[model samples]
Target: MNSGFHGNTFAVIIAVENYQFRIKTVDYARNDAIAFQQWLINNLKVPQENIKLWLDVDATKSALNEELQYEISNLTESDRFIFYYAGHGFYDGGYNKITTWDTHPNNIQETTVSLNRILMEPLRNSRCNQCLIFIDACASYIDEQLVSRDFIADMNTKEFSDFVRSSNYRAMFLSCSRGEKSYGSPELGHGIWTHFLIKALNGEAPEAVERERFITSTSLQNYLSKIVPDYIKSSTDIRGTQKPWAEVSSSNTFIIFEVSGASSEGSNNYIDFIFIPERLIIDFENDLIIAYLRGLENDGRHFLMYDYEGLKEIDVEAYCIRISKLKNEIRKILEEIMDFLMEYEWEEEVIFERSDDKFNISAFLYEDDKTREITVSLGLSLKISGLHPMGDTIFDSEFDVANDELKIYTDSSDYNVEEVEIQEIFSDCWDEIRRYFLLEKEIEKELLNEIDE
Candidate 1:
């Protein structure tokens, strides 16, 4: 019987406003809000059954009524509950307050939610193992000429102190250091810190982390530190602070979060091939020949060459080693081909062949490998039967570089002939030819590695 229980659950609440009071001049707050939701759903691997997402432009006291409170209360029984707020925060004389859409700077009491009430009453009592709160509140001081008292206040308070002292499993990440004001820009779609947080979650910076590295909080924090600053500079006006903060429960266990199981081997192979698109055909042909030769070498096979009743010297060991090396190269190329297939969503089978002073390579693509959809082929022949020609008719004028490029020359008069038309055909086939050879080179490198090992 299967013994593993279902993985942990997470709940996220993004509350932008408190009472109906709206704070103006948020640059990318809306986009940040949406990105956070997607990060939870797609990257964080949060289960839908356990997720309760609360999003509002302005969440007033009435809006967060009994029903919303019940839902938020029920989420406490979950494994983890995360609350994220990206709006204005005010400080009354004693308590830290979050502003609603209708809040006024002069009258803080009418449109604000006490931070203590939001966390201690509903969230802390929910019975969750962990509660993480992210706040990007904008607090500023105005002179007495404009307002009776300073609206911005220090984050430290009795309620905050009590929560910190009492809740060991609770953690909080603030946008700015205490006493410093957090600023936003029209360029960044959200607060600078929040922007980086989204990127870290998306697995975009330093490339996405392997599924294995994402299990620990330390790894996740490391990833966040590396990625957030760059994203902030690029997209937002606010710069990230030197010391970002995070808190995790001492007793909490790290869990490996698996995003997906699709192998990355094929993607790497495809990238290598695309890097050197030319030489693909020559490489593939060479690899195949080498594979065949290696098999012969292993089996103690020999090819005898006779010229006009004369016998050539035979060295069996030398041939075996050479073929073995070639076979190794071929195997490497095949590995790359497999990787390329996995990275991209393409259905194609690659084939290689060589005959009578000519090397030919083809790719057959299908909806799936089982059904043939299309066939594209390129051939290199010494006889120039179907060679693409240079426009100049004088053949001896230009020196032809062997295997570097296929070339043909036709006079104005011969251009009308069907043979000249073959030049156009092969010219278009150059891209495929290059790709085949590139694949071959990668295979060769792999073989070299195997031999060394």
Candidate 2:
């Protein structure tokens, strides 16, 4: 069922910043949409031709449906589609409508695009199985004191959830809840909510890690769901009001994009790991190494480890598909490692680094119980080259860790794994090390009876 990473992802961006009718100025809504579209290009590697950007004058009711129908009609269940809207959301206490330039509150039913209709008919009926919907403008008229008394009601837009839950494999993220305002600041030059989103897309979210760096619906939701509330509470202009809502018809495990940044040595090469916690990161890297080894062994392929510089670059999506084939094995190895290291101050947090479809690795040392001399564990998550493309449809991801047979032991001194770098409390039992590096201990017992005295 895994389409892997090569699935064709299409998107439609609807940003209505100007209104020909009674809508108030929603400063920077168009800027937010434009920035989001660029993010799709830079991070997700979505083909420019696949994305449709409709802003201001063109985001009418007919245009939105026409775009969705055509795009969804072409896609399959193996592919993905996203719809993002940032502008005025007019709620008549039940029906939620995304307003266009031609939309007037008096003539809303006929003029505005019904979010429910698109999802129900064209989107649900389309060949595409998964839909990601982000609506950034909600209750704008009510929050800004612009709604007329006739439209105001004691009710809320909770019925919108019925439509949201109607579809399977769809995730919906709204800028605010039923009665809340989605804010924008002149300082940010875009909506504050959207500003944080772009930053998070670049791996700046609080949940971001050095190793596992792809942004997902869960990560984005966790980030915005927390930060937006904090910002509203902290700001003087607005407080105790706005709250972003994210709902998935099923578990939202979809990966949106990956982040790239400078390498650890301050070079332009995309870094593999950065700012990962000492214990959690080490185990992640250690397990992945084993995963790579186990996968290679299971596939009956020869394994070799070299500096990341030696690895070849290939297509990211294609590369990920290769990894997914072995991901189940990787997951098993991780579980075993967790059980094996239960005595250590272990946390399961982990991340990986890759770019252009090749992996680069890194891990740094820091003290635990900081005042004490930190125990340098048996493993080092060193940087190494990863899988290289074998052909158009296959890949080679072999790693052995040992360059030569018995070289790690006979020439153990050569490995930079001396006592200065390694610490062991009970010197005799290096059980963890033995299990990790596949070392077999051979102790010779001397016979005293054979001595001639």
Q: What is the overall TM-score of model 2 with all chains considered together?
A: 0.53
- Give the per-residue lDDT of model 1 (tens digit) for 1-453: 111114365655555523343335444555666777777778666767655555554366555444445655666343666667666666775677766555565766766677776655676567765566666664535433221111466454335434533554554555643333454545564556677666655554433343323323333444444344445445544322222334333233233233345343333311100010011111232332111111111121121110112222233211111223433333343345445654766543333323322222212221212333323222222211111111111110111122335443332111122334445433433444345645756887899999999
- Can you write out model 2's per-residue Cα lDDT over 1-453, one digit (the tens) per residue? 111256788999988787788667677889999998998888778899989998888887777667667776788877888888888776553456677767775765677766666654676677777777887776622432453111222113334445445665566777764434678878788887788877887777746322244555655766776687677667635432454666544322455555575223432324332111111111223332211211111121111111122333332211122333233433333345434445456332122222233332211112322242222112112222221111111111112223212111111111122342122211222234334444321211123333532
Question: Which parts of model 2 are misplaced by more than 4 Å?
Answer: 1-4, 92-94, 140-168, 208-211, 261-453
TM-score of candidate 1 to 2 decimals: 0.46
Clash counts for all predictions: 35, 4
- How much is 204 displaced in model 1, in angstroms? 2.8
lDDT of 2 at 257: 58
| lDDT, model 1, position 109 | 74
Output the number of the lDDT-best candidate.
2
CA RMSD of each candidate after superposition: 27.7, 21.3
